[model samples]
Target chain A: MKVLPYFVILPLAGSFLVIFIDSVLKDRKVRDTVADILANVIMLTLFILTLTLFGQSCSYFVGGWRPPFGINFLLDGLSHLMLVAVNLIALLSGIFSINYMSQYTARRHYWALFLLMLTGMNGVLLSGDFFNLFVFLEIASVASYALVGFGTEAEELEASFKYMVMGAVASSLVLMAVAVLYSRFGILNMSYISAAMPGESFDWLLKFSLFLFITAFSIKGALVPFHAWLPDAHPSAPAPVSAMLSGVLIETIGIYALTRVIFNVFSYKSILLANLGVISMMVGVLLALGQTDIKRLLAYSSISQVGYIVLGLGLGTPLGIFGALFHLINHSIFKSLLFLNSGSVFYRLKTRDLNSMGGLNKVMPVTGATSLVASLSISGLPPFNGFFSKLIIIIACVQSGHPVLAVWAVIGSVLTLAYFMKVQKLAFFGKLKEINKEIKESPFFMSASVIILAALCLATSFILLPGVRNKILTPAVNAVLNPTNYRMMVYIK
Target chain B: MKREEKNRAPTTELNGMSEIVKTVCNWIAGFIFLFGCYITAYGHLTPGGGFAGGVILAASFILIVLSFGKDKISPLLPRKRAEMIEAAGGLIFIFTVWTAIYAGASFCGNFIFKKWSCANFKLLSAGFIPLLNIAIALKVMAGLFLVFFVLSITRVILEGEKLKMVKEE
Candidate 1:
């Protein structure tokens, strides 16, 4: 508990430390190495620390002030699960960046911004109040905006601007909703808000604020109509950044934050949310089918997968929530792997267009294999983790007498497979491009990151086991199922 | 009278101001910088805190750059040194938090001299707020100046090239 906030503090320190070391050191090699080591160490440390918080539920108040008076760091099953996914992806991306980012200038600033983004994600997960959530969300959003334009090319700038505009609008909506909630209840802590929200007067003001939340969070999550920025923004960023953005960043601020609010804070699942989820799922996959850029395809697929989670959550059943939570972790794993695979291809070939490349497996065995694994996992092939979660969601749908949703979900899954197979065939398995004769396998670090993720793609199936499920996924399911338990021990005056 | 006229001659550039504005700017820049420091250092006891003071200090530098042109005054506060200052400020803040934790308090906990020593509301009364304020001030001051400096440099290069092209033609 004493070390809880360091999940946020360490990354903040690491970012500054990277910049400081760069300024002090004259040798570029030494600076890069030190920055790489520091970034990996920070992520690794946070990973271990977050794991230590597993199986325990506690809150740490900043400055030792009790909740309702001062800011508190809340750790429960849901945040703990998110912490694991965020830190794990960050660590892998940090390693992958070691070799990949060497091609870019001002590696120091890149590392600094990366660390700041991690700090923001961790802070978002841990903070127990609404205002802090907005602040951390801004931190993460600002860093991502800079990162998407890290290349500083014309298209990159355009994409970043689009992302930033949408992000700012969403943030303002969130702030207004927070203000409304505060005006209604005179409180900012989520637990207190949840405790007080149950009065019979779930009135127009409250409903309006909840509607604002749905709009704000849906925009952040990139649900259907709100998702235009994602395809452009995710593809424009550098590869590791693409991996983080497509993999964990959207899920953290978008899916995770949205669900946490609707599930716990609002403690009510609207039918509208469910319909939006179905639309996102169908629209995202269909739009993804026409994409040639591997990263953009993966980005669209992220929206589709997120739709599954939201759809499951919107069902408002134990099995639906379970499936949603399970799919969240599985999606983080495979989608990041897929993005990293795309990054590797981009790194070696210097292009993201799938049509321009062919037969990469002849030169890049590890990338080819890992991406194949990712492709399989995401397509809901048997034995990979995606299958189990998708199966559970389908089961939940059928059990809840929503076979139509289950049918659309099956259609979405089939579309997912078709697009990924298209990606694999076009980019990896056909005749080697005559101009791409010199393409080489990615370095050890990049390969290692993907291989580990791909391995976990198959390995995470253990989560559905009774014992493992009870320890990790079940607690989170319970946390989401019971919003009233959020007030645990933090006596609300 | 001839020597006085020479001393009062206007600057060379079309956009630059006359000598009086430049001289007044140079004179007030130091006061602005000092006043910024005064506010940041006593931020614990006063209303004007680190963020406000830092912006003021950065504005003083921006004023000098604007009046004298970036080429003349940037040597005193170059982008390199500004980035260094920004990083150092961040380091100071996180280190302070780390020390608080190392002393068996929580992160951001105030472990330094907790109780006020006297009845007087001295500048050093707070345990960590002043220190944190100074660090934030340094970061904000350097960071804002860097942003101004970089944007100005880009504009200079673009416009300077056009000027060179006109000269060549």
Candidate 2:
């Protein structure tokens, strides 16, 4: 409970501290090395901090102010899980970027912004008040917008601009929804809001706010109908930025925020979630099918995979919640691995266009092997973590009397394989192109980052073991399945 | 008529506005900046907080840049110094919150002194809100100035240099 504020404080402090070091230390070598070490250590510490919070649910009020009157921080089962996933991936990406970002200038700014985004994610996850959540959400989103265009190319600039505009509009709508809720209930605390909010007494204004939240958060999340900005923004960023964006950013800022609000606050949006999930599942896969750019394909696949999590959660059963949370973990791991792999390939070949290369397996064997691990994991093959989560979601669907939704999900999974197979064949296999003969593997850190994630792809399957599931995944599922537990803990005063 | 029109074409005392605008700006900007500090210092007890006071402080710098060109204004505080100051502000703000937790309070919990009645309508009484406001004001002043300077100076270099070239041509 006491350590909750460090989640935001450390990252915010680290960002400006790096700036101070960079400006003070004239030597470029020393500056970069110090900043790199500083960032990685901070992220690793944050990851460890999240791990400690498991099964030890807690709440903290800022400035010693009590809830409903002062901003509060709540760490329950769901947040702890997401906190670990986000920080773990953030550390991996930070390590990957040490080498990957050297190609670009303003390396100081990049590291600073990366930590700022990390701070935003951590704060968004930790905050129990809606107002503070929105503020942290903006911190993460704004940092990402700047990072997306860090390369400063015309396309990168344009994509970041597009992301910024739509993001601002979405933020406005979310704020408006928050305002309506606050006006209705006279408070913005999640526990207080849930306590006061119920279908029996809720008026049309509440319903309108719910729609505003769902639609706005969907746009933020890049769901099918509101996903136009992602394909451009994700692929346009530098590789590790792309990895962070697709791997954790979308989930934390978009999916996690939306689900938490819908499940805990609104308490009955399952039908809306179910329909949106099916549509995104279908649309994302279809759109991903024709993408030739490696990162763009991965970006679209992120949308499709998110659909699966949403579908599971929308089932509103304990098993379904478990499936959703499990899939969320699997996606963050494997998707990050795939994106970092793409970044490594881009680092060597300086391109994301799939058709420009061939038979990279003969030369860059590490990239080949690791990407294979990631691809199979994402495709839901056996022994990998993704397979079990996909299986659980499908089983949950069938058990919940949603046979048709199960079929659609299975179809989506099959489509996932088809597109990934296309990617592997075109980008990593086939005849070796003359232009790519001298291609080499990535720097040491880049290789290590992907290897770590690929290993995690296999490692996360252990969470399925009966004992381990009870320890990790079960509590997260329980937090969402029963909001009353959260209310009692947060408002126990 | 042509000579009278030429006299009002907005050319300056060399590179900036007329001497009157520059002189008036020099006096009033200091007052505005001081008032901004006043707001930030008393933010906990007053209506104006960090954000409002920050904009006001930034406006003073913007005013200086507007009347006097880049040359006259930036020499007082270089761009790099401005950035370092901004970074320092951020660090100070974090430092306050970090210390609060170490003082046996939660994160961002005010634990400096007299935690109970510290904020009881006193200027220096509020544990850290006033200091946080000052930090924010510093960052905003530097950042807002940096943005104005960069944009305005870029125009000067791009257009002024081009215009000089045109005159030579």
Candidate 3:
């Protein structure tokens, strides 16, 4: 049996299983334990399956039907890379949630929603049809909106409401675009759309559809102007959830989908590249500098980091694309680590307010130390993963003869360092507050997750080693750069 | 049931011109709501769909709330029943989509009775479209009812307590 579909099927099955078991168990400790372990095992298995599929291209048609007439689940180098990132982070988030969610009343409901989210992310990463992608995206987005509101505190509900409204609007816009595409192309399969493209007129309607798609995706991705919802939504969820949102959710669904649609379906438009890239990069950092809430600050930084990735992608060189993919992987690692670390702080401190915190390193060694590593890594310091990706992006920018963009990239990195350093100084480095003297380190599972992600932050730079790069990033980059090959592979088979 | 006594006297004021106006308003609201229902059910046939139809149905519920007040509407559909109906609607929508998978079509492929034909373009003619419309209507009506019911009850509870406290003071 092919293992590819299991990545999505298992999580979807697990979500139902969790709901069913939880309803019977009535929130028993044993049931929660079983659910947590089951979720972790499922994600770990998916991680292994993703690794197995690396460098091996495969596609599964739903209900045993062939493509163009059936919905296809395509697994290639890019998807494999995404699957690994998504599952690895999901696994760690599951681990983190075991301890982090203990304070909440509805443990089973949390796991159910989390699994549903996992199913959505997995489906989005693997879906080969536009409509399938949209549906899965909604599944994930709706789940995330609920998760953000899970706390039901005043701010949490407000944030969730805002997120739901914006997300709903984005979904409607995406659906409108999908309807246009379906009517125009008459086939929902992505590969078929590209194959049928040459003779089709790129009329006003098609262009309008493209514009709608980009606008909707930009909102989902939290790119600058359309990003009002991120700072509020990301910070309100539980720490593990916040980590997932910042780490992988935006990148996978928002950036990855946008890249796929723009490059693959619509073909790359240079005007889209320069205009969107420059504006997002400038606005993302400038806004990030003004935030005081640690998680909210980190959320803005996420916008900035995404800006860097988009800028690299916009450059449209082989090097630029390579850098973009590298940055994407690296950002997922360190940023998730940072968000999880922030969760650790919130776990102990019980407050996300930076001003209220002071010199916690003395009390919480693991959290303080891991956070520092994440901070430095994110700020593009050497020997950490962030530096290599940012360096590559800058090099790509310079090589592309956009000196101004390279300068902005460097400035953004410096701005990232400045804010993270402020976070360190206020929250960890100074004298311990008397009120926080009783504060303790988070539970073992939380610490363990942070350590693992922090280790990845330091170690992922090795992926740039030619063998490692070829084994992983190259195939993904090649997949994006060569959309024609994708068409031929799917159609010829 | 004990609370019903307190509301009985106020409902007596719903008489004469007020009663006629209320009935007419309810009829109009119900008509507009049923129109929304038709649009949602025939969405796959025409332009309006589950969402548009759902919104229209909700508007009808809102209109009923505005014209007749909460007590009058509450007896017709209680909170729990509304919640259950909404849940059922959601289930129906999901089930309808899932059927496509079993039929060897992709999920949500509009595969009721196979082959996309317009022969049944009328109200009863569209295969799953009418069912979808009914599902959306249930979801919308129940969802709106729940929201309005909760809001109304909370308002009464809080205000009643406040009035009682003022009397004591």
Best by lDDT: 1
lDDT of 1 at A80: 92
How far does residue B98 in candidate 2 sit from its true spot (Å)? 1.6
CA error at residue A1 for candidate 1, angstroms: 1.0
Query: How much is A259 displaced in model 1, in angstroms?
Result: 1.7
- Name the DockQ score for candidate 1: 0.29
Cα TM-score of candidate 1: 0.94
Q: What is the TM-score of each candidate against the true structure?
A: 0.94, 0.93, 0.78
lDDT of 1 by residue, B119-146 (tens): 4478767778889999999999999998
> Which tens-of-lDDT digit does each residue in A1-493 have in candidate 3?
2565676667876765665555455347888898888888888888878777767886776655778888778877888888899999999989998998877766766887898888899999888999999999999999999999887655787899999999999899999999998898898898888777653457887888888888898899888789899999999999889888888999888889888887777765563564476677677777777777999988988888888888888888889888888989888888888888888888787788899999999999999999999899989999998899889989988898898888988888898888899999999999888899999888999999999988888789899999999999999888888878767656432
List the candidate 1 regions with Cα displacement exceeding 4 Å.
A199-201, A489-493, B1-16, B113-116, B155-169
Q: What TM-score does prediction 2 earn?
A: 0.93
Per-model lDDT = 0.86, 0.86, 0.80
Docking class of 2: acceptable
- Fnat of each candidate: 0.53, 0.57, 0.05
Model 1 interface CAPRI class: acceptable
Residue-by-residue lDDT tens digits, candidate 1, A226-265:
9989999998998889889888898889888887888888
The docking quality of candidate 3, as DockQ, is: 0.08
**Regarding TM-score, does 1 or 3 come out ahead?**
1
For DockQ, the strongest prediction is: 2
Worst 10 residues of 2 chain B by lDDT: B160-169
Q: What is the TM-score of chain A alone in each candidate?
A: 0.98, 0.98, 0.97
